[model samples]
Target: MTEAVQIRPEQFPLTRECPFSPPKEYRDLREEAPIARVNLLDGKWAWALTRHEDVRTMLSDPRFSADRSNPDFPQMVMGRVQDDDAEKSLISMDAPEHGPARRAVLGEFTVRRMEALRPRIQEIVDERIDAMLAGPRPVDLVRELSLPVPSLVICELLGVPYSDHEFFQAHTATMVSRQSSVPDRRAAFQAVQTYLGDLILLKEKDPSEDDLLGRQIIKGREEGTYRHRALVAMAFLLLLAGHETTANMISLSTVALLENPDQLALVKADPARTLPAVEELLRYFTIVDTVTARVATEDVPLGGVTIRAGEGVLGLGFAANRDPEAFADPDDLDIERGARHHVAFGFGPHQCLGQNLARMELQIVIDTLFRRIPDLALAEPVGKLAFKDEAAIYGMYSLPVTW
Candidate 1:
């Protein structure tokens, strides 16, 4: 038997030098070491999967466990212990448990449900844009448009009051930030969990069938399948994820389009082009790259490399979306490319549940923004804009714009 070699690997997740692009080192890694070992934040090492094919296969396979409670699970940072709330999150569960948990709430995010909510989403977009136009020139788009649209939508869906968005948004920012200390992250997690627990208790007293969380609560009580504690954790995950990820994408996608005028014109000329434009943007700005870490349950050879049982692997979604093997001229932002196969929202059973809603929201926002204000442009140079470099989710902290 070949003795497994142990060595300190190159640091993983090299800082994204370009705000809108993946790290240059990722391209080099994809070419030379598609499945190479690399160092993580906590001094531990794991195999980093850089190719789209390998990442898709690995994520779909049952051998790789998504359970955070697993002792052998590979962590992005060290010494971070998951609390009970973290353990019950659907994103952190494997099959059997993951399947039923996901199914229970899956109906809420279906295409029909999202379509029914489309008019409201459009209204919210217009309302925000109206306020932006009325108030001032060179407004911070992040605050004015990007954040509130989805934040309001998600709040309504989850039955959480949108007036308290600041509280949970602050907590979520700390939770996903790489620079946040372990204690800070834990505190953020607890704060959101407690808030959701309180809200769910109120819903239990007066459940509404129309609302997502209320529906889940009623079903959970009748079926006895979903526990109150588990529901709180689930709500916490949805509320944070429901707003943060889509909000960042909105800001990042807007900046990308503004920078590429020719592409922006395409979306502006024909409203029908907006859908594919959104998909291309999703592929190009594959933001949530680091969240899909998994631990191998058995020996698996991938991309000519063997990932041993008990080993850790990161499915680098940004690199995979940009892989030349998956899309022709992956670096270029082509609105017509229709790169729907991209892993921006991930793949397999763990694919984003709210993707349909996200897609519709982006399409409406982009189309409406450009149509209403054709002269819209960045207030400052793209390089000068503040970006969330230290956060796992790639996006701008603030986007100042004028029309």
Candidate 2:
């Protein structure tokens, strides 16, 4: 195998100078050093994968473990948040444990289940749009529509009351931000964990058929898979990821489409085109690119290098999605390009379970927003907009827009 470049971990998870694309270093790494040792935010040295083929290979390969408790597992976030509990979140689990954990909630996110909720999702998106149209001009979509849509959906899904959205949303934001102090992130992380843990306890005692978590509680109990701590971890994952990632995608996608009128026209003119457009945008942003990290269980040869046992690896989703080898003119946003292999939702056993829900939400939001507000335009210049550049997930902090 070829030698991989060695660099300090602090030099990794490079900042995005352009809100629309991955960090400039991603290009350099993909072309010159597809697999390189780089220091992470926590100063841990790990091999970072930049190529589409290699990222897919590494993520799918069982040799690279996803157990975050493993000292060798990479810390991909701005601040490392640890739970003292022995139960690991599904995203951080490997093999036998991961499979059962994921399968427990898999039915909740299947295509049929997600599709059944489409009409409800449609109502939510349209209602948010209606509120936006009636409310004051120059609204922040992040607050008004983008954030609320997914936040509401997930709130109802997990049986959490929507009135307490601010509490969880605020804490969720703190946890993902690079700017958030370690103590602050810890506090936010704890606040949400405590809240969810309590909620899960209540749900377990009185299961309700009306919600996903409630239903899961009943289901898991029958299967002998419902451990309180483990359920808490799953609930936390679903609650946070359910809203945050999809919120960012909605805002960023609106910006991308607004900026590219020609491309926007394609989506607007054809209702059938919205699905591919949503997929393309998801691929284009690959917002959660930094988090798909793993550590080698044993030395595994991949992408012209051998990632040693106990070494960390990151599949640069943004870089992999934008890989020229994976698409023609990979950097350019082409909604027409049917790129099904995009790692936006990632690959392998650990792929995002809420992806079906997220996709439907995006499809409905994108299709409805533009159709309702034909004159939608940016109220502020793209360059002046503040982006969540320091966050583990890249997104616009606020998208100023008017119809």
Candidate 3:
């Protein structure tokens, strides 16, 4: 008889120092046991969903609640002051609450709306490319392009002054960096919250006809249902979630392309193929690994296993995208795999609200990069590229690039 396969605590900590790619153990575990108990830091246990189908089901299933208000819900980082309030955001709420809260901003992120922003997005991408070309050849893409393009775009969209980007970016960095101490992270959160709260008050005083926050404020005022705290929470959510995920994707996808010359050539030769390629790359490099955590509302059987009430489950986005059952060859980055069915943005009602904007940003960036710098390649050796292995969102600290 075979010994029951188990994921050792140290091997699979929430903060594993490894490449952005999914761990090989995930594939092994998915084949042997899709749903297995994993020991976390402090000897806590959480269910890890690895299979593609299982992950999809778990994400959409109502029984798997993201109610962060629950006592047993796993915290992103243990022992943080604003951890409770941070968890109460849309990502952590259950259906009835999560749905409407998400709907409030859905109109801004729809594919149609995102399409309308393409020209503006393209302009932003072009401006970044021009800046990169003007600067040092081996500049860090994270600082010049990956971080700024999305950062500025999100700022403009959310009605925040672009001049304040540096402060917000620093605050966001400290909050998301795993290396930061509890107090430091808490301080960062408080700073961002306070900053956004002030911004909300300003918007309330003199609202604009456009911009997401402005529109939200107007809607809330008209409906007479807007709570100041909710506005602050949504603003924080949009700023962090809107930019960070896409920024990581842009950097990671560019790295993946530079690594695979053939694929890069394919994309460079025919820019029309970028959208599908972006989809494939998004699947290939699922960076937000295990960031989405949900608690079991009640006893529910899943994937031939019973999950008890109050037990937490993590939807391993990285693992699920690489499930062999979901794709013909999960590891191979086939540009034409028609990977639209992939769960990179997740599934169900709580799917990423900014997915459209994300896709648009990726599309424009890829298109403009190839058009402007067809000879683009990584400046440093692939092995030498530094990854933020400890980040909640798997990413490269700096992607040095040259043409």
- After superposition on all CA atoms, what RMSD does each candidate show versus the true structure? 2.1, 1.4, 2.1
Off by more than 4 A, model 3: 1-6, 14-20, 83-87
> Per-residue lDDT for 96-130 in model 2, tens only?
87887788789888899898888989999889998
- Which residue segments of model 2 deviate by more than 4 Å? 1-10, 77-79
True-structure lDDT of candidate 3: 0.81
Q: How well is each residue in 1-403 modelled by candidate 3, as lDDT tens digits?
A: 1123556656664443245457777876688778877766545778888888988998888998877677766555656456554537777678788778888878888888888888888888898889999987888999899998898889888888889988988888788876788898889889989999898888888888789888887888898877778889888888998778888888989888877888888888887889999899888877777766788989989888888999988788888988888898888888988899788888888888888888889988988887888888888887898887777777777898888
Write model 1 residue lDDT over 1-403, tens digit each, in one string.
1222333433455668688678887887787778777776667778888899988998889888887776667676545636644546898888888999999999999999999999999999999999999997889999998999999999998889999999999989988887888898988877888888899889989899978889998898889775888888788878877889899989999999999999998888899999999999999988898677899889987777777899888899999999999999998999898799999898988888889989999998998898888999999998799999878787878999997
**Candidate with more favorable, higher TM-score: 1 or 2:** 2
TM-score, every prediction: 0.96, 0.97, 0.95
User: lDDT of each structure?
Assistant: 0.85, 0.87, 0.81
Which candidate number would show the highest lDDT if scored against the true structure?
A: 2
| Steric collisions counted per model | 0, 5, 1
Give candidate 1's total backbone clashes: 0
Higher TM-score: candidate 2 or 3? Answer: 2
* Highest TM-score against the true fold, candidate: 2
Ranked candidates (TM-score, high to low): 2, 1, 3
Error of 3 at 59 (Å): 0.8
